[model samples]
Target chain A: MNGTFDPPATGKRVIPGTYVFDGDAARRGFAINEMCFSFNEDANRRAFAEDEEAYMERFHLSEEHKKAIRERDVIGMLNAGGNIYYLAKLAGILKLGVQDIGALQTGTTVDEFKAALLAHGAKLKELQTQGETA
Target chain B: MSTIAGGIFTSHVPGIGQAIAKGLKQDPYWKPFFDGWHTVHDWLKREKPDVLVCFYNDHGLNFFLDKLPTFAIGAADGYRHEDEGWGISGYKPYPGMPELSWHIIEQVVHDEFDPTMCQKMLVDHALAIPVEMAWPDEEESWPFKLVPIAINTVQYPLPSPKRCFEFGRSVGRALESWPGDEKIVVMGTGGLSHQLEGERAGHINIEYDTFCMDNLSRDPEALLQHSSLDIAELAGSQGVEILNWIAARGAMRGSVTELSRNYHIPISNTAAATMLLENHETVLA
Candidate 1:
């Protein structure tokens, strides 16, 4: 509020490759997120694993949500209004670590995502070292 | 009156909990992050504050989008940690200081900050991981009582940094007003920077994170300049958890001295940090 900052160009500032998960998205993804929220329980996770389709039906998930889950498409899930935190439960059921989900979203291998993180960290270190020496 | 010893701001990534469960503190990937806790542990051992008022965001454990409060305070006798669907093993229920919780809640609400009062609440990794990291070796139970204050960072229309800072100041005033003689330590958990949602999933902003570590204790208002949306843009969506750190920093009402600080990057797609600040000449607001 203090600074003279420009307002976002569009009604919503579109950060490339980023989703804001705002109210619109929340309303859009409520059912899916609610279903993912239920995954907090081990029994629900087990039930989902037991009969994925039947569980989806119980949540009243739309075909779009069902397809996103079926394909294990993290980005598709996001497109369908799935918050990353709730979707994390789904990822857990699928045995996907955050790095795995990152890979899936970015279309990279898990190893590649890990390597990119390391490289980014190393870059930061290099910059800091330069700052110290400079 | 209750005395605020100081504050500790830490990252509460669930992966840290996973690392601890697997005894991988010494593993190469986890060592840098875990190593940062030594100074915090030493400080805690020496200070031994009676209660820790923790400011953290719940990750779909206690409150879902069904009805989320902007801020909530726990008034329970004990808080439980259950499986978060991510296989992070549960810990024994944490002892809660309901007397302190209710006192703060009453005072804060009187001060015109209405937070949802929970008689029973389930704490998630955001609270648990920091406790585990701070006191890794304690097997039986945590030495200090906990007062969990959850702020909503998960949903849109999140509280602004200015709002959280003011709420913390109110809580600080509440703590100072309490009649008990207990020593208290305030804690804020989560974020230096990292995102996990989109193509920007592995986003890490070293410059912003360093700025935060350097400025939080001395000039927290500098942090309040960024609106929630600005923070989401600058710190990554999840990185907005820095609001926890801001709120914790605001709770100290006296001159602050940075005791020790550590920042490490790429801890499970996040830049993790831990900082300890000692509040000197603790004064009434």
Candidate 2:
């Protein structure tokens, strides 16, 4: 394998116009970014900690589902299919094994459990697919 | 039965393969690995794997730091290669298995795994450089068909390791269900730890890397059982990403039969390691 490069020409997507984020565009972009990446900030955590149900209302997920995940209830989150994928991230946080995150915990193989997961991730991807202007 | 050749799971530590080959062979911690893989190079000629499904991450070089896809599969008939500032001439335009790639993409997405399909993307040296050096092909055209599976690692908050591992299992299931009769090999490229950024650079834990290489090939489930935090503690912040290899292990039915594991450290910005495993019915060459 040497010097020649044959780049794939199809993956690049063309956009119409560019908008500066210094004005109204910036405000809108921040709002959207906040909406999607809301759970990580300290302020949001405190707010959600105070009124979990009300906070859940502001977002797309249900209060019960959000609570279950916040409490690290793995099975409840998985059964609910409500932001459970993120909870899988907690397996590492909790010192649980990687395979143990889902079916691998129950002594079943990964294949038996992944189809259901891909479907959930697929749905989530659709919800968050379109991003703002570059 | 198709014989299994070997699998590689290494950190794409920039100029690692070449740098290590240059001077690391003398370091006590590094010398054995160099010696071990010296044998693997010769074996590849004899074993000759027909296909390789490389799992690598684009270091903001291809897709950029702008938008990152959680899991992207190369489906184009050919890939656009990026020149890595380094003077190395890289691989020829890689031929993609569009029909099979798309078939798997559709099935996986249909089954609920959303894999971004790439037609035009830069094949960064973070991936191409080390991979080529590991098993250099001097005669021009590659000896085998290629299946490139890229994961987003550079950008913060990428797919969770659990998600990555499960993706590998899904990929394995996809391959198992593929009707084609060709022989195949799978590799998980990147990381054994040592953060490239922040103040925690140059960290190396021979024990942690050794444990990772051992468990990853034979009993990955056992390794994944530990929390990502545990892996991070053992490996380092970026090292926690080793679970990414679990994805490749997943395709091999969660059990690795044939193994080639290499570990080296402080190669540029990371502690690097590589593992090559074989799945059932596929021979490793």
Candidate 3:
């Protein structure tokens, strides 16, 4: 290190485009995340597939979790404190990839979600040029 | 003095690990990504560096919410791959270069990098996925000794891009000062713009990824200007892992000769990318 390295900044804005899975969020999502983490085992995945309710119960998921799991509600799960990484395991069980979760949250088809994501890059470039010229 | 011979930036998506494990290289979905790796495999063979200072973010394996070290370095004798709650198993143990690991850790701490030091850690997909992707051979141990540098990309208040870059420079300086004839390659495993959470989850910014990748080989300092939020704004939240890549770029303080670059979309809802760079002075000199 040439000069002293500063530690990561604390309490910054959670940028407009993200749902940060921070400490509070992690606490809220622990049960749900743990439930999803169980899917690492084939038997656990099979158990979840066999009886979603029972599987969730075994993990001691909250009522909100059950509702989120039952409804296949991405945003609901997130709001109920679902870390996307852990939610991904549940998404895997639901045959929903992260893109599907994104689409569900953003109210777009998966194709549209991808298109929108790609579009932002072009928009950012335009903004950059405008800033440069100005 | 030990030499930092090169730097590699790559995505460590677990799906890629599954695809490679299932021999899905010829599968249309995977062919492009695998095609991008041929040059990487060849470079690894040609360079045959002694060790890899691998920077990766742990998934849910070793450290979870209870205690997330903003940055952790493994000084373990060897690393065992964790199950990662996905039933994926069976990997040859990854040997560690504890001697070199301690040397760099001491230097980094002295340089005020403030990394959590680990005597032992079970590496999850974040580290294992990339290693398996690079060297698929199950029977043989990986050729290069590893110094696992785990970053906290999972939780909030993750290290800033500039901080990560400075840590890399510390490691680079440490490598240079050590009185050892070791050839080291700093490998960063993560992100090229894909957000896996929030309403902006499926975010993949090709222009952002492309622009960042382009600068990585030339003006990495330009990347330091962008904050984590700025990256999240352009890339996705998880795409913030690009800080690992920026750090690897920082390790290459000398001129870099770009060997190969590959970018592919929709690798499990992420735009996967990889790049290989050789130290122009180190290799040529």
Candidate 4:
């Protein structure tokens, strides 16, 4: 499913810091996603953990996909066509939660990412309180 | 005719399953989220729906990217939860109502809304966690049978919110025409807003969530104004799960009234919400 990365139609607007995971990305990342999808089974996860290189070989991953997996680069994987939902299975095997991945992609420490989330929550609470009193 | 009891909509974040497993519902961080379920529990007990039609998305548990369907309905006699590659424990299988499932499938198909019919399907947290939340005590077996209607939120080119809402209305019409004395509750389980990918991973939009909670019952049509891309931009990438809520809302025919709602933020980086809507009018078949 990999060849040239044909960009999505001209009308689609790009959101900064966001990857849409459209058909182009899907085609590009199919091997990586297919491999991650296999991680659903314990034995497969074990197999991958036991020998990451061999496991990627079994899935016929491209050199780029293997590099991204080796470095644990979430954005790199996304750029290589790895959908977040499927990539999450691989993240589980690596003992990283969504927040950890968020921190990795956003270039923030885990604590800072968490603090930002908490601040967002606090802002919502303040808004609600104002709505109630006003 | 089977009665549509109402619709229950909530966020089905996987972390909630972990919280329940760890018995952390009363923990300061989780208390507000768990407290919201009191009204839902009371309503479920009082209404005693014989079957629950769940509108949820599968997060790589049942279907893979090989051949993802736009809409799929489970006609299995029972649905099981398996290990989803994550550390979350599995739940006991929920009994299914295959006859009712087939009825909805046939009815919706006849109504020109094509959906993949699965006589055997596995449910993920998107379907399981909400049931566990609603019936926390029912460990061995849940009281109500299940009809799982899975929509594809994991892939691009997802069915539009309008399409899902209309499919739900078709299912509602099917349920209304069924010649049974059973009461049914439809559930939409998924997001208010949360993104778990890219640089915008921890994104949450309370304003959009509030707009959804306020209008889902009173005026769901207002939601269709935003296209799927608009939702992803405003609600976050994963937040498009609100399509499930829209469909659940559509299933409630006749006048709908909001009974109770609870919305909390930062429940595993999500603006979690639970809502109950009741259908006041009974339609004669």
Candidate 5:
């Protein structure tokens, strides 16, 4: 433990690990409790908890779906896909205004927001071509 | 039951972690905070705990908006560091206490506290700050034995304050049953009251925070009955995250002799409260 600051006997100075059940830690963590849903206000968590139906009405989402999102039950959320886009809408979040719902729900939405931007550009070009230009 | 140093409560707020890395002995507001913490430093040196169970919430670091763990424990030899996007790179590595970590995992749930056990993970800034500041002498080359506790505070529908308290009791049970000559201490950090993000970014409820300081000490069970929304409403969204401290308290039993309590506001849009807890006779030098 001398001479210009050396590591322990192992030379690696192996610190203890961070995971308790490391076997399937990341995968299990992802599948089990994957989403992070938050409100800008606790009033939101409360009002929603008090009367979810009322809360859902406040947002663009449906009642039953709000329950899954709030509960953090991902499997249920995916199964009840009517309002799969509800969370995105509530935040006024746009993964591009138009998305292929079929792909988004299945987790195969290959296109990123940039692709959506490109699609918007195509629309602009069409509008210019068909312009009743002033 | 063996002597428990009780639990430590701290804010996993990213900003504080960043501030400490710059050698927090400076900065007008922070200078005082460090001066205050230095007392704890002195105390810790005298009563060096064999193992420290740190409770912190990861914010987009370690576990992100993509994937989050409810409760994760480190069972490896050393943990890796993180950047956290704030120019504050995390510790190179943090040593973990696997035995105590595992015992808590097995026994806690049986005590009605289902902990999310972490294995092969990284230490987010939330758990790193107070550890570094409080015990800076821990050698990364051969660091002190540490066990990192990552709580699911950031993601909504988090564990309730009462649940955290019960979980603490489970932790206590686990520690009591451990076979060792090691002195153990638990610490909870984060929030007497404060919030960040969105229109409520600057919210502070000094009164509610003081109330938390009191109730969390005496009647945490009653406090847990209150919805997470209440803490979020009073303290701001981030304020409710402090329920983990109540968990820290629950583990300490009804007899916590408070060593010291300090509360501060406007610490980068946070209401910061820090405390050292143990039974009266045990805490006395």
Candidate 6:
């Protein structure tokens, strides 16, 4: 119960729609982030691609962290303390962009995620027109 | 004496850098965005400030989760373009001002805004992209001295929007009191909207972004009422980078005359924006 005071923001526990990569989350995801950070190097990216499990184990990530990596779970990794910036390196290994992570978290296809972004542009144009008229 | 000549606020989206790197500025997809900078390029050519104190957040170039500084200043003579996971090619090194960097570091610390000093740093797109956009003719090299300031907006426990404003004020004071005739420009880059990753992944709040830009030059203080969470929720997680814009506004001291402003959407997962503001005192009499 030591984590008692650390109540989640809402009844849903996780912050709705986002995972903030804060200090405590950084602490929790240290090993996982360290492994991901190493992917900055082409050699490190290649090493992980060659032998995923062995490469992950070298970082000594916890079972939960390892599982999240194994499953390619972006949100799970976030819950386990994976900062999205660092997790992006892992996402890179999987050829996934931030949109892919968004798609996975929101349960949408990549094309749909892209469509939503394009729609945002349409919405902006509409708002600009309204502003001009007003 | 050194003076805070003006402030330039813009979005330094990574894709903008890619477009420049790949020579795709003329492509229809990028033409509109690049067109926005045409005025900025002409403006920089005329202003040609001696030094530019560029403020931006690092994604994952120089600092990792191991040891991240809340506020860090680069005092090196130059910085090379970081690979940033994907390769970044053909970016010439940016010149730095070590003398002015040390003076501000000392003065701002005295002003109680303790920023970490990085003697060497590989600056990522957040700082590099805006410089490139403003000075599109890369063959001649960067004209102004750059003092790269990296704020920790990436991880949690980010400096409050209010605190960021205060920090910029301290830097402004430092620039003001410094013993030099150097013309200085403060640049705050990043954000309008568009979240990169999360359940609300392609989230773009034009209203919030518009509200921010419309009011930034007039009542930047009004924005403080909107907490970081309010910004993140209304804008996006990465949208919090607007704090740097608030800081840039603060560096201008009080009311500034806006010379130019532009806002465009979908510049690589963010709503891109630019504003050129001159200090009230420095404006034509």
Would you list the C-alpha lDDT of every candidate in the order shown? 0.87, 0.53, 0.78, 0.88, 0.55, 0.79
DockQ of model 6 vs. true complex: 0.47
TM-score of chain A of 6: 0.84
The alpha-carbon deviation from the true structure for residue B16 of candidate 3, after best TM-score superposition, in angstroms, is 1.2
- DockQ of each candidate, alpha-carbon based: 0.47, 0.02, 0.29, 0.58, 0.02, 0.47
Ranking by TM-score: 4, 1, 6, 3, 5, 2
Candidate number 4, chain A TM-score? 0.90
lDDT of 6 at B253: 81
Off by over 4 Å in 1: A1-10, A131-134, B282-285
Pick by lDDT: which candidate is best? Answer: 4
Q: Flag the better candidate by DockQ, 3 or 6.
A: 6
Off-target runs (Cα >4 Å) in candidate 3 are A1-17, A37-61, A108-134, B136-139, B280-285
Poorest 10 consecutive residues of model 4 chain B by lDDT? B85-94
Measured over the true interface residues after superposition, the C-alpha RMSD of each candidate is 3.6, 19.9, 6.1, 2.6, 21.2, 3.2
Candidate 4 lDDT by residue in tens digits, B1-285? 788998899999988988998899999999999999999999999999999999999988899888799999999999999888985655878899999898999999998998999988999999989999998888578899999999988888888999989999999988888888899999999998989888778989888888888898899998988877789989999999999998888888988989999988899878899998998675567
Write candidate 5's Cα lDDT for A32-60 as tens digits. 22221333234554565577566565645
Instruction: Encode model 4's per-residue lDDT on A22-114: one tens digit a residue.
Output: 888899999999999998899999999999999999999999899888888788788889998899999989999888888888888999999
For model 3, residues B251-271, the per-residue Cα lDDT tens digits are 777778888887776677777
lDDT of 6 by residue, B1-285 (tens): 777777889988777876887899999767767777766777777877889898899888899866789899999988877667664545788898898889879988998887999999988888888888887775777778889888888887788899888888888877888898988889998887867766667778877887887778778888898778778888888899998888878877845877777777776677778888777564444
Clashing pairs for predicted structure model 6, backbone only: A22-B156
The CAPRI quality class of candidate 2 comes to: incorrect
Best-to-worst order by lDDT is 4, 1, 6, 3, 5, 2
The DockQ value obtained for model 1 is 0.47
* CAPRI category for model 6: acceptable
Evaluation by TM-score, superior candidate among 1 and 3: 1
> Mind sharing the TM-score for model 1?
0.95
Deviation (Å) of B265 in candidate 1: 1.1
